[model samples]
Target chain A: MPEVADPEPLPVPLARAGDPAAWDALFRRYQLPLYVFVFELVRDESASLDLVQETFLAAVKHLGTLRDNAKFGSWLFGIAHQKCRQRWRQRTEVLFDEIPESAGEWEPGPDDLLIRREEEAGFMNLVAQLPPPQRAALLLHYVEEFSLEEIARITEAQLGTVKSRLHYAKRALRKLLEAKNENPA
Target chain B: MKTPRELLLARHRAAEPKLDALRREVVAAELNNQATREQSFKVSLVTSLLCCSNKLWRELVWPCRRTWAALAAVWVVLALVHLAQRDGSPPALAQSAPTAGMILTFRDQQEILNELFADRSVPAEVVRPGIYAPKPRTETVALLAA
Candidate 1:
């Protein structure tokens, strides 16, 4: 099947002014990436969907406060992060790093392209193991292509803190991968 | 298979799970939201005045577009500053009666007033020399009211 070309993200002014076409463009541009980010934070697909919805709605409501158009992606991610926190507050169980030991068989579907490499799945599992802040910083750094400053703004952490989260997260992931390989469990 | 940029975006799109129905649901909800916002946009008097002022300033006063915008922004900042200062200034300093001197709390003020009025029998001069002169009941009370 041929892939359709994605449209550019709507400019901030349009979304801030409540344009539906702009909103649709924004939703299409960020939905997949946001789902991935939120899903890593909270492992349930249904919960991720709700969180995504809540995040978008909150973004819409508070769009006026956003001063810079370039930072919309970080702003949206920040809202999703807040939603994840809200969900964590509501729930009692802790399952941030608990993927099944055996890899699940991939059903023939669209999302296969993201995990096309086997190690991509391994990478994601290790990602799940890191603490929430570190995982967020790493994902924002690598997956979302955000700068340290952008990550700091999104996570509401000091620049030094964001830098450390990325550094520590990478170190911890490296250790986990090495341990996994040595043992081959 | 378009440009390299398009290909990259396509890969990102591929990360999206099969959720055509969900996407439809979200889009429909946004359209509904737009409709509701459109319907709810009955401009209040203040909003109309603001819109009209903005238009008038842009069109006539300093029609150089950018200049007028800057001027309007400065004007708004000045107005807001004036309003904030007006609101935050100590009004009680000017408005409080001299006779109600140095009373802190409402309960304390009430107690002092009770003590003063309870001894209504005291000749008005005793309270303050010449300040509270010997006077009929109505005159004394009237002076206190003032």
Candidate 2:
């Protein structure tokens, strides 16, 4: 058999200067992860959606300022973080709305579904208690599967700061879970 | 003894948000809206600027350039006349002594008015009493009675 070179990865669809389809593709690809990341930080489903929308709107207005198209995911998240902060500043109280029933039906074995739901609720509660930066760092690091450097880039923080936030967030979450287990009420 | 981070990660995989139909729909709609808005706004802005510049050059600048230039020239001539008047010789010095004497008489009348106003002991009644009346009605009645 003859040896063959590996094909290159497909180029990311950047929202071109005025290409609506390209922008749509980029948004479809990253919106979920970006929304989840913002949701983890703010802990409110509706507010997270609003933040995501505002972030995209801002990105559209200022897309010319972005230097690297390849780093669009991180850039979008950065804008989302700024919008999240603005929302927080404007309204200090945070409200965590239950996930909409429209989020669709879950089909799993009964035990598995129950366990998963409990875990998700517990994890979300823990995440909600974390400070904004630490929560963002943890979500990007673990949930979004971004590396330390990527988290730093997205959060516009130093690499060490990102690492420290993740470390502390994990420790805090562990302690919280342990406390919950001990109480069991 | 504590569990490692990787172990915790494995245990929590199911807790993540699933790619459900509704979620997908919401994401698609939001993305579509964003892309459309961005594209439309950019196109509109470019079109508006182009239209504005074209109208300015064709309807405004070109049509008004001659009028603007003529008005500018008139303004320059008026400015030069004022400047010349300021820098030219004193007309007072060029006048005959009789004309200068008339100017001195005008100055004397002004001086008399100033002195009359300034003199505290001179009853206001002696020098244009009606002129200094506090009320118009009193002066009017006095004039009518007179």
Candidate 3:
């Protein structure tokens, strides 16, 4: 039998300090994840895009100051979190009635797209109803796949505070989802 | 009951924004916008250099009060010199005046001889021939002609 070589791992995408192309490459690699993260945080497409753009612009400007290039994902999300906080502070109401109709319109691949979308939408709606800290914690913990420590770093909260928020957020979200399911709204 | 956190994140990844088209459009537009802004900034800078206010130019060119004062003094001196020459008047003060020896020797020879006699201790060296002979008039006439 012929020996098979293991495939080379794809290089982790990292923006060179101040290189726009590198920033763009990083943007391309993480845009979707960051966008979804922003969308989940802000719950509006236009605001999410604006926040993402601001985050990227801020990142590009301050890229040289970043100590670790490998942690670009968490760094970007941290910027996104700051932007979200600023926006939330400026506007008393974070929830928008105008959810993107196109969000529901996106077709899923071979995976159960509709079911996942429904679940996501339901989860977001439930999350939206929670207090801001809890919501942020839940979104960072679950949707963004940030570890508890990463969530703390992103949110600028202590580890215990983040854990508390997550605990309460999960309990709140479960109650909301269960209530919705029972009512069949 | 299934935890909402696990279920939400799993579904969230499924709906993640695919970056193919959006990335290209956003990045291209951003880069183009930056280039345009830089070009506009350069144009504005050049325009300001060429057509900036006279006060601004004065401030830039002179930069300091001492320099401006020096420049003013030079200009005033030049202007006075020019006016004097234009009006055909002699300079107020000649920079090179005749020395005392030239004037006294020419105008008051008796007094000069008296002063020399009072100060002198005569020696054999005073008897050197042609020590005080008048120069030949040829060189004098040539210089006067020039």
Candidate 4:
């Protein structure tokens, strides 16, 4: 399997050293993907844009604290994830049940479930309906192509919790797809 | 049929141009934020350093102000005394050492004083050790006779 690369190899070292061009390059590379992820989670364009800007600002300020420069993408995603969580907390008090961070039974991963082009809109709508944590996990795992470990780090959840979320999220998506197929409106 | 990744990408295709516009805004905003943060950090650093120096003065210097003043006064007095002693020292004499004629004159004065103070009755010949002539006192002769 080919290792998934971050859109491009960012000049993290120069950016960390406070280079303006390097910072611009880093933000340019990640802006779209970061905006997409934030927009999907928050569903507000202005808020998402603000969060993206906030995330980049934070990345510029604290880039020195990031130990591994190679994991800059996941690290940036982690920042945006925290921003979304903060926004969610401010907007509503939605409580999530405790998810057991234990090894779950075998299940079909998102990769195994083929999504047809026609079902894209319906699938995204279903995805939006998932619980915030599950949606974040699914988006990070499938859409952003982050590994389970990366998703766990980005979400600040246990590795087992990440796996459980991915498992349940894909299951819920499949059910929604089936239901939509049966009631072809 | 497409993978979920491709489908999601397709779903977001419409937003790319908007994202492109937002990119310039985000970059500009981040640059401004970074500037503000750096400025705040510099200000905080200066404030902390000033606070630290003040604390040091209060803890280490203010408590011993009297002792330090007394020590400074003693040093001042010592410096003044040293300067006064340096200035008050006697000047060197201008005259050279005494000549041989001065030494001969001193010896002649000493001889004349010894002669003037000698007994006139005891002549030089009578005062010789081998020709000793005894001049007895009357009281001594009477006692000897008795």
Candidate 5:
């Protein structure tokens, strides 16, 4: 990515050397986008936060394993993606939704709560309806704006596979939206 | 109605403003815990080696530390066992080993022949031919003097 998103990106060396500020800076740079991507997959904000924490911890721990420091964003996303896959494979008996909710640090307040809730619910419902892999590709591409190569790396799929996933996802979403218009849900 | 792509982008963009607070928290939490979570000794060694020119060597010896540790443990156990076995056993006897020599046994030739031929008709004793036998120490000294 261009330096525009991060004017002074944390050096990979400093992070690899276990520099606290570097790790903090790295976490700050990617946490929101990564959380949104994970929350989209798991459909639980709490679990999304856990997965984000897990991803950053893992990235910080295994920073040396990363080949290109510049692609840290994609690599970190890949770790989060793996965590989501693991959560899917080993689901606990308790419904994540049934769990008591914690007070999040950020509340929408009286102003944005109702509108944000509706938009978030609507967008999430649409995205969730797509096949998991396709939805992941779409989110990584459109929402996070990862390059095609980066998405392919994060998804651990062939470049062509990434393209096809995005292709099928957009087509499926468009079709669903058209049907929704016809039915006026 | 807006297109689906537009809706996705719009939602993503709007969501971030609210999430920035949570992101800040995540950063703070990670930074606070950083000191306690340095890479382990083995991992740090592997990490250093991996950053070297022989990165391929790093893969080959990825489990080197653990393997070396196991081997050292086994060696120490074996050394301890050997020491215990040595201490537990009695010391070797101080007596000397038997000497080498030749001796002869003279028997009745006719009786010997009859016994060889009577194997089927009667139970015959089997005898082994030997020249040397261990004698008492006194006899040994007397024979040596002779």
Candidate 6:
């Protein structure tokens, strides 16, 4: 994939001062990205829209908690991630961390080409099938192109846990691809 | 062949246009929320100031009205007493300047006394110095012996 350019810096101080134009500029910049991240995780259009709005509103209310303005993107994603977690918690009693780690068994090489254009739909299907934690880690790491530390901060996971989840998720995806390729059904 | 990141981004790109309406709605909501919060803050501040002023009046000023009136009455009485005393007293003259009549009276009394004493043939209204007046010789000798 071609590298995406860095977006214009957000007007964090103006937004903090409750300027409508500043908040609008911020929403315009992050609304789509935040929606995509949330929609991909939840797979519900309405929920994704609501989550995006909620994330913005949450940003408005607790903007003072953000210590750095340069980190606005990750911080906004972090709020969406937490909102998704809340929804998940309400729907189920299952714990996200208890999912077993298969990362130990699979050591994917640096040059491994795990995805292809033809397998795009299959790849997303398998990704959606992944557990919430692993899927979140993968999307944040690959799709959002956040650093491993940024992913950890966004997901509120440990650095090692983020690494492990990314490793395990990719390994699982590769296995799914291999299985599909072998069967050819 | 596209990478997973590229494929995912393309897939989600379909939904971007649909979010324009949502953007307008969210921005409107945020602006409205901010306006409401600012209005409430202003109201609360004004209410607090009004409450503070009312509390000051109730606690400090209204209850002490009797004491304030009594203080005013005392001041008025002191002022009246001072004015009455000032009105009754004689106006003072400068002590260094005496009137012509007072100087003339003083000089006349001194002259009369001096004249009476100087002429010993007239009975001296001023008592003559007894030691200088001639005493009888026998009385003087007897006085000396005593």
- Among these predicted structures, which one has the highest TM-score? 6
What candidate 4 gets wrong by more than 4 Å, as runs, is A1-8, A96-110, A178-185, B29-146
Docking class of 1: incorrect
Clashing pairs in 2: none
Which lDDT tens digits does candidate 4 get at residues B1-146?
77676666666667777776666676677667779889999999999999999999999889999998999999999999889866975533534677899999999999999999987787878777785556679867997899
Computed on C-alphas against the true complex, the DockQ of each candidate is 0.08, 0.01, 0.11, 0.28, 0.10, 0.32
Q: Higher-DockQ candidate among 2 and 6?
A: 6
For model 1, the stretches where C-alpha displacement exceeds 4 angstroms are A1-9, A93-118, A176-185, B1-20, B40-146
Candidate 2 chain A weakest lDDT stretch, 10 residues = A1-10
**Residues A5-117, model 3: lDDT tens digits:** 21432123334423457656677666766776677666887787778777877766676666776666778889988888889768875542122211111121231112233
| Residues B62-113 of candidate 1: C-alpha lDDT, one tens digit per residue | 6586777898899999999889879885777787675644545766979988
lDDT of 5 by residue, A1-185 (tens): 22226667557778787666676677766766677688878888678777877787687668778988888888889999888878976885332223232322211122111113334455567688766777788788755577878888887776766776766666555565456557764
Stretches of candidate 2 off by over 4 Å are A1-14, A93-118, A176-185, B1-146
Evaluated on chain B only, what are the TM-scores of all the candidate structures, in order?
A: 0.21, 0.32, 0.30, 0.41, 0.22, 0.38
- Candidate 6 lDDT over residue span A62-181, tens digit each: 899999998888999999999998888777866666777644532434634556666778898888898999899888876667888899899887787888888888878888889878
i-RMSD per candidate, Å: 7.2, 10.0, 8.1, 2.7, 7.5, 2.3
- Residue B35, model 4, lDDT: 94
Q: Candidate 2 docking category? A: incorrect
Local error of candidate 3 at residue B106 (angstroms): 35
Per-candidate TM vs. native? 0.52, 0.47, 0.50, 0.62, 0.50, 0.68
Model 4: per-residue Cα lDDT over A38-153, one tens digit each = 88899987898789878977887788889999889899999999999889888986644353435553254436767666677888898888888888888887666888889989
- CA-lDDT, candidates in order: 0.68, 0.63, 0.64, 0.79, 0.67, 0.81
- State which candidate, 2 or 5, has the greater DockQ: 5
- Note the residue pairs that clash in candidate 5: none
Tell me how far candidate 1 lies from the true structure as C-alpha RMSD in angstroms: 23.9
Scored on chain A only, each candidate's TM-score is 0.75, 0.71, 0.71, 0.86, 0.75, 0.85
lDDT of 1 at B59: 78
What are the runs in model 3 whose C-alpha is more than 4 Å off? Answer: A1-14, A93-121, A173-185, B1-22, B29-146
Winner of 2 and 5 under lDDT: 5
Error of 1 at A183 (Å): 7.8
- Which one wins by TM-score: 2 or 4? 4
